[model samples]
Target: MNSLQKGNGSVVRRVKLATIHLLALGVLSGVVVSLHAGEAISPRRLIEVVDISGPVVSPDSSQVAFRTEQASVARNTYDSVWYVQNTDGKTPPRRVGEGGVPLRSSAGLSLPAFAVWSPDGRWIYYRALMDGKVGVWRASADGSSAKPLTNDPADVRNFLLSADGKTLNYSVGATRDEVIAAEQSEYERGIHVDSSVPIGQGDLFRSGNVEGRLATQRLDVLGDGFARVPLLSGVPDRWKAIDLLTGKTRDLEASEVPSPQTIASALPKGESKPWRYALDTVNHRVALLTRVGDQGDLVQKPGVELSVLLGKNSPRHIECQAEPCVNKAISGVQWKPGSEEVVYTVSDPAEGMAQSIFRWNVKSGEVRLVARSAGLLNGGQRYGLEDPGCGLSSTALVCVAADANRPPRVEKIDLETGKRQVLFDPNASLAADISADMPVKLLRWKDAKGRLFTGQFFAARRTGDRPPPLFIAYYLCPGFLRSGYGGEWPLATFAEHGISALCINYGPFSFDAVERYNQGLSAVKSAVDLLASSGEIDRTRVGMGELSFGTEITMWTAFNSDLLAATSITGALLSRSMYLHGSLKGKEFISRAHKVWQLGSPDETPEQWKRIGLEFNLDKIRSPVLMQVPEQEYVWLLDSAVPLMLDHKADLYVFPQAPHFKFQPRQLLAANERNVDWFRFWLQDYEDPDPEKKSQYAVWREMKAHASNRGENPAGSRGD
Candidate 1:
């Protein structure tokens, strides 16, 4: 200003005046504003997560359709939609056109989801909301031209499309309330979720043919833009359509038949009882699956022949074309690609666990050995039947094979020459990617009783070294262990972090839901004793983790036993009492809830409930535990669950928003990573104690160090 020229004097004065005005404004506001954030941010900051689930491949197999929620950058919440993407995972998926997310309310929790695909794969047929109500909608493969396919008021259970894409096949209904009542009865009788009876919603409708108007309407693919068909299948809604073109939907050929007294005497008690009904297909063939006392048999009428499929002599081979060709030697059957031939697993029922694959010509009634892929007819591990859908082509079928120590391996079978090739071997993958030098052993032990129990042990690569922290996972159902859907992360993630893992199957001693509800305590005890006796598991450093109903069992052990050094219970079954009262305490198997809770409900039997709750006796658990709950964890933990644990001072973490299921890869990965770290901290401490526990100044020094590393005031920063 002092050096300003005469010609610019007015400009200088104006600039000084503007500076004074800015200072005045700042003084008036009494706050300083900056564009960038400071060092620390909120720990609760929301991150966008994707739900890439229900993968559907297009006819060309070049594109895949899936459902997920996309984030609103401003609002910070996601809306659901059907999206399409390249199958190779190369391209990012885009929405199938613009539409509002279907509102999930108390009236119905079922939202529109991917259901069927058209013949050409150019369109993804789904049940979505068109206005404010629920209905079926179809969208182009690329998320374009989304239009309604059905306008049924009742909820759509599932859907199918004709090969020509001109007809849409679907089933619709309300949840089976009666089936739920029956389930409640079992729970009341001390049956847990796993032990409860399984009743199909269709069973509720089985009283008669679906009580609905039935007729098929031709889908005009090119006209009407998009058709909105009414709800078809089941009772109450009473809207159904029977296609005249394809034999996809029609009335039953015959009523359900009662089990013969002899068959009933042979059948297993409880839910193993089977119902028989006839499916009226194009050929007027009748299909029946019935269970008697201990024996289950499947018979197709017109042929008036039967084969046992589940209980005794469970029929595996049945040619249902004209002459009824029945073979007691077969156990599992799958219709071939053309639906002409049936591939069956044939073996002697008395052999316990053995079988071979055979092909039966339905038209010719000729049975021939396709392959002797040993254990095809084996009762225990090989009970899973081969189906034509698993085949990559008309000539090859995909099969899964497993042993006690290893997970199942996928294989392809050639029908013509009976050659077999391993498609993807989990065992080989674990060895190659995890360790080659480590001694991996599959061990079996019998508890005090003579029954056998199986476990997998991964010893240190070097000789004579105690295995790193041993972890156990009850992945599969006790009854279905060999081919069960095992727990996902504990086995693979633990290996990734150089930790030894043991997968224990608590089967034979207690198999199926009824056994699970009845004998969980004994089964767990047996498994623990067997594992400890082997001396392979570091008894002092062992950690346990399980999910779904397994979480219920694991928590029971954590509460009662001091064997586990650390534990994780995801999707916990915290309360049985609430589930039965229908107060939304937890999600339950519709058919099994009624009778299952009586034995374990805290309200009914205080002592038993105390044991089951795991909260009342948290002090008994010596291990540092981590309990993660999803935002909507009604499937397991209810409103009372978290508070009960908190009252007991249990270590817990809550995912602000998450689902009951574990199909999300990222969330699962994060959980696994945290588990590995927690176990490592506890187990590694067993070998080397943290010396920093000694000095008083050590705490301050560590704090300062942390602050320096974190580049923030450790004492002041609370991550926000």
Candidate 2:
């Protein structure tokens, strides 16, 4: 009756981990232990998605073209497919695109999703690989005809269709010499390569007869090209506007370095305010947004300058911050369907701002706020809304509305009536699946410092003979798990096996910022106090887990607080202060992140190095720690990893060449396998579920025995 509720029903994994290794995986291992197919989502079924993104509502509003991704065990990652669905919800979604197109990358089997509906609703235009080349393709709305529209060998990386359905503005990557020459030209101007330099001393270098491009961006050595920064703003790389009817193109963005000032003064001037049409739609006008300055930071005011190009008339600058324009960061601007009102959204999370939606009348040039409910915190990347608060269907608007209690859901905000109605319940299946096994609730609490925080709480619906263990995980956890970027939290697996989960958004969700880190620590404190006082969490069995910067919080909580029995941390490290700036070669990411988290250099933040930085403070950690790292992560973290495993009561799991964002399905399942085992044994004295596994559990047993011998329990003991 409750199969999926109790376990992830059986689906054979490509690289199944042993029971002990699975347990170390923490939350997911419990599902596979007693795996089978069922209604609700389990770790085994984590591959499914509730929301379909990049939805293009057709002109008549009869159909919606969108895409979704599903995990593929064959590829060890997620692959995408496109679908068309009736907006009225009468008919089930008809799958338009399928996987099985072979590709060279590790993401082996599948097609890319660039699907969009043609303005007339007769066809759907998308980019896909065909005959060893990636090009634009189209399919009829009724699914009767499908064929290649553009055959370009260079491959279209990104493209958009014109309003008249006659033009395509596409961008392609730079070529080998193009990339190298840009890097070399920029480097020569910044650093004078005299006779002392390696190149200057070479026999060929002494002569000016060599080819203009000798290989740069390290492409000659690395075999991978790196792009040089553009010399001008609002210019696309290798941009071309093609007339689909004529098979001819006008070069809109030329990649050549601006001619030297001396050479430029001798030449004729071109158009003064060059514009690249972003959406040259059938809607009868061209819309373009250009960065204000070369810096291109979108968070600041006046970040972009908007330009409108009418038929033959000159392009005009649409004032962004003048008399009638908005001063807040304009994150987006889109022309309303069949109207002239330009809708935009403001996302300033640092100020606790919701995503306020506004509209500008192109004829009157008057800007006004239409919908001010972006929620206190916005997961800006989710759902891929063309207009967050306003998707026009003739006179009505479709929106993803949100509030403190509800995650963003599709709704129609009626402009005339000022009333809102639910449009689509994307997560209905997901909500039913997980909620069947676990009772989910929203939790709010105040820390000792008197700051209020909120988080999502989940526990088993039926807690039987023994009180359940607890695990707290967090990071920018706003509203619904609808985006389907990262799979749902392993709450179902955890709850079914007697574990509860609480995830919080650590202050507006900023990366590498000190202010957010402090807020995360405070939120963790509040979570611990609230969960402990509720008496639902087994006092001795409280564990914790974190990914990315959440590891920093894990480090602080493990060392400073005595709430957790065990913990897992990944994604990033806490030892940025251990290495000097620029020490890790080609590792400017580390250097920048370090500066954002602290001041000056590792040498300057010695005290902070010991407090929150690299020093590990391993001697003080009360909970057993587990750290899983990807191969591509920086090496300095390994320096901290050794001390954590060898000296402290911690373990490490490292995946080869795995990207930090997510693991291959095989690796991910194994990781979850290990986590479930870790929490199970530490919190409930449960051993390996599979009797065959030995070495992994043996090591953990020794760690537990060692701790037990010392008469220590991070949280209250089982004796309690």
Measured by lDDT, the strongest candidate is: 2
| Tens-digit per-residue lDDT, 1-720, candidate 1 | 000000110000111100000001122121112112221111111112121223444655566565543333334323455666554434445567433343221111112234466778778877554444345677888655887655555545445566687766555554334434443564466434222111111111111111111111111111111111111211332234435245244322223211223434444343243333222233223233432222212112111233323333333434243222343434455545434555655443223223477665655666677766322312113211111123223465554443322333444567789877653332242223233333345555555655555555555321236545566665442211221122234454454344566555444322233345334445556655665566644555666766555566666666666666566766546455334433322333222332333343445567655644555665565454556654334333544455544443234555533433332334544465456555554555312134542442333234334434644322112110
Summing lDDT over every window of 10 consecutive residues in candidate 2, give the lowest-scoring window: 1-10
Candidate 1 colliding pairs, count: 54
Q: Judged by lDDT against the true structure, how good is candidate 2?
A: 0.50
Q: TM-scores for all candidates? A: 0.51, 0.67
Model 1's alpha-carbon lDDT is: 0.41
Location of the lowest summed lDDT over 10 successive residues in candidate 1 = 15-24
Q: Give Cα distance to truth, residue 488, candidate 1, Å.
A: 6.5
Over 1-720, each residue of candidate 2 has an lDDT whose tens digit, in order, gives: 000011111011111100001111122111112222245445544433322344566789877665444444545544544556566655555656532222211111122234667778888887665544556777776656677766553545567777688887776555434444555665666634322221211122211111111222110111111101111111234666777778787767455222222312222245343222234245445455554543332222234565554433443445545443433545565666767766666654432234665666667777665656634222213321222224456555555454432333455455445465554443343444554555566676777767667666777543465667787776544334321112323655666666777766555333334455566777876776666677777656777776555666667777766767898865446455223322322344344435445544556766666766535477777688776655434353666667766754878776654433343567666666677777777876776658665777887877777677767753423632
